[model samples]
Target: MKRSKSKICSNEHAKFIKQYKSKKLTILFCQLGLLILFICLWEILTQTQVLNVLIFSSPSRIVSTISTLYTSGDLFYHIGITLSETLIGFVLGVGLGTIVAILLWWNESLRKILDPYIVVLNSLPKIALGPIIIIWFGAGMQSIIVMCVLITIVITTLSMLNAFQSVSNTKILLLQSLGASKFTILRKLILPSSLPQFVSVLKIAVGMSWVGSIMGEYLISSAGLGYLIVYGSQVFQLDLVMSSTLILCVLASVMYLFVALLEKIVHRRLGL
Candidate 1:
């Protein structure tokens, strides 16, 4: 009887996988088709000279621009600076956020006491702090990291709080009935269950961190991608602006992929 059930489960799982693959393929085809159509129209317009290349450069022009920047060494230095600031800020934010989340979960009274301060921080506009951050940290990369950290930390806390609180009452009760200690319940239950949401917050904070870093650089900086954009625009170099924008998108996407991978591993391990 057990063998029969196992075979049935295996067959059902195979069917489900096949159906899921078909749906994924359909979505991929639709997205790819739209992308190709848009690029075709863009290339045609540029080649026909119907769209002014000065304002709206061709895809080819952008590609050539990327090629030139690769040879010039300017792109690498700027990219490195921005990436360093972003990664450092992201790590600090996530590390602090997780620590705070666990601390608050361990002590509800402290969480309640700190609620007001959390609200005020969340309400504050990170962009407004750019000038102040530059004054405190100086007008360069460190200031940018500081700015990004501020933007991410509060949001991370909020996200983690929600996740930490999502542990089911029944699960806690079951563990309690099984003679589980508070520390054990927290370590094995609350923390593990919050992994998915923590991953989500990390992804969100990635974009916020990048935005804060770049905006800080924009307000005051001698290097980095945001500085590149400001300098390019001031000099009417739209190509540089577009290139920086593309690089930002890529950076955010890479960060997002890391979060996604973490989420997948956590979910699979927890059978969530």
Candidate 2:
């Protein structure tokens, strides 16, 4: 009887696993199908003159522009410059933000004192400060990176500080009752409990970082994808503009996917 029951349970588990895998595969297929359908529709509309080819610039035209860029060896160079600036700024922003969050969490007095200032900074238009930033950092990659960091760091700090403060008061009291030191409580309880929020912050940071880098490029870059868009507009090269925008979309999507993958890994490690 026991052996039969165990065998039945095993079969049910196997069936559940198969269904889950099938569902995932179906979702993936649907996503790809949707993207392909959209592209086909876009191309067809442009070809039929239902959409202006010059303005909408069909996928074929964008592909040709990309090919031209690749042939001229400019494609990878622009991509590399933008990618490196983004990555550097992303790392710095997240790192510095986390440290600031920790400091704020460690000192209630300091947190309160700086709370208003942080809010003011967050509310201020970052772009409005562009001229000042350019003057201070000069018109170069440094300025661009500073812009990216400035955009991302505040949000990261705020998100993380809230996450830290959101820890269960009951759990914290329990730790205190057990005579755990503040640092011990933070290390074991606060950090682990905030892992999900950290992942959420990372996801937000990814998008913000891209926005910052692109905005910075628009301000003063001579190279990079943003530069391509600005130059294309000035030259009235709609195809180039569309192609650069498409590439930016692709790159941002890839970065978001990486953050999603990281979230999965973190969850798996935590047995979530």
Candidate 3:
């Protein structure tokens, strides 16, 4: 009996380890394949001169350009400023947007009253607000933050409000039948049910937050990935343009991963 139990335990452990190894190997292979394909395409194009080395830039040239920038340590400051703007704007927008959502959820009458205003605000191109924000706040971090908030908050608020209100009717009724208070119903039923939607909206808001920050940099103010791209383009420094773009993509991907991790944690905790 003891030998049989030990054998079963060893087999289960081996199977789990094998599964884990396979997953890691799959991820590694995919990354390796993509890297190989990208390098091959770059080398082929450069060899053929079909891709202008100076214009499109070979991968080797871009690496050299990155090394030069890294040695100068100039990219750190630009990256810091842009990341600060993006993170702050994202936090403010999502926080305020959530508050707005909760408030709207609390009062259906208020939501109905403000419905048209919400439509108008959402329909108004957030980019159009850039000039006004600049005029109101006068060209700096404040205007940029405002633009980011303007873009992300309204949409988040609308989505969360709808999601909260759309919680399962049966769930709400069951809570009511248990003589639960409104707060109890919301706390146990509505809020929990709306979490999946919140996670999705958070992902969307993160993208919008990046958009707002970049647009702000594009329209006004001095430093950011967007500014670097514009500056690089004007001077025809394709390497700098490419580097800044890579930085933006990396930053956005990190933020995306963060939200994804949060979603996974939520699912695990809720047993979803």
Candidate 4:
């Protein structure tokens, strides 16, 4: 009787897992179908002249332009330059932001002192600081990197700080009652609890990092997708503009997916 019951339970678990996997596959196929359908409609409209090819630019035209850039050896260089700036800025911004968050979390008085300033900086228009940044870092990669960091860091700090603070007080109190040191409480309790929030913030930061990098390129770059975009507009090559924009979307999507994959791995490792 006991063996039969155990076998029944095992079979039910297997059935549940099968259903879950099937659901995931369904969603994936649905997403792919939607994307393909949209692209087909877009191509049809442009080809039929319902959408002006010069203005809207068909998917085929964008692909052809990208192929041209690839053949000319400009595609990878522009992508590399922008990717390098974005990755560097993202790493520094997240690292420094995490450190600042830890410091603020550690010292309540310091957190209070910096909170208002952080809020003000977050609200301030970063684009207006373009001239100052150009003067300070020169009209080069340094300025572009600085722009990316500026866009990402404050947001990272605030998001992480809030995550740290939102950790349940009962958990901390229990650790305190057990005579755990402040460091121990933070290390064992707070940080662990904030992992999901950290991942969420990382996803947000990735998008902001791309925006900042592109904005900087627009202001001063001689190359990069952003530079391509600005030049394309000036030259009235709408195909070029659409191609660059498409590439940006693809790159941003890839980065977001990478972060999401990391999140899944971390959660699995942590058994969350």
Highest TM-score, which number?
2
All candidates' lDDT scores? 0.85, 0.93, 0.87, 0.93
- Ten-residue segment with the worst summed lDDT in candidate 2? 1-10
Ranking by lDDT: 2, 4, 3, 1
The lowest-lDDT stretch of 10 consecutive residues in candidate 1 is 1-10
lDDT of 2 at 235: 86
- The TM-score, computed over Cα atoms with residue i paired to residue i, of candidate 3 is 0.84
By the lDDT metric, which is better: model 2 or model 3? 2
**Poorly placed runs, candidate 3 (over 4 Å):** 1-31, 177-181
**How well does model 1 score by local distance difference test?**
0.85
TM-score for candidate 2, residues paired by index: 0.87
Steric clash pairs (candidate 3): none
Q: Between candidates 1 and 2, which one is better according to lDDT?
A: 2
Error of 3 at 21 (Å): 9.4
- Stretches off by above 4 angstroms in model 1 are 1-26, 170-185
Better of 3 and 4 by TM-score: 4
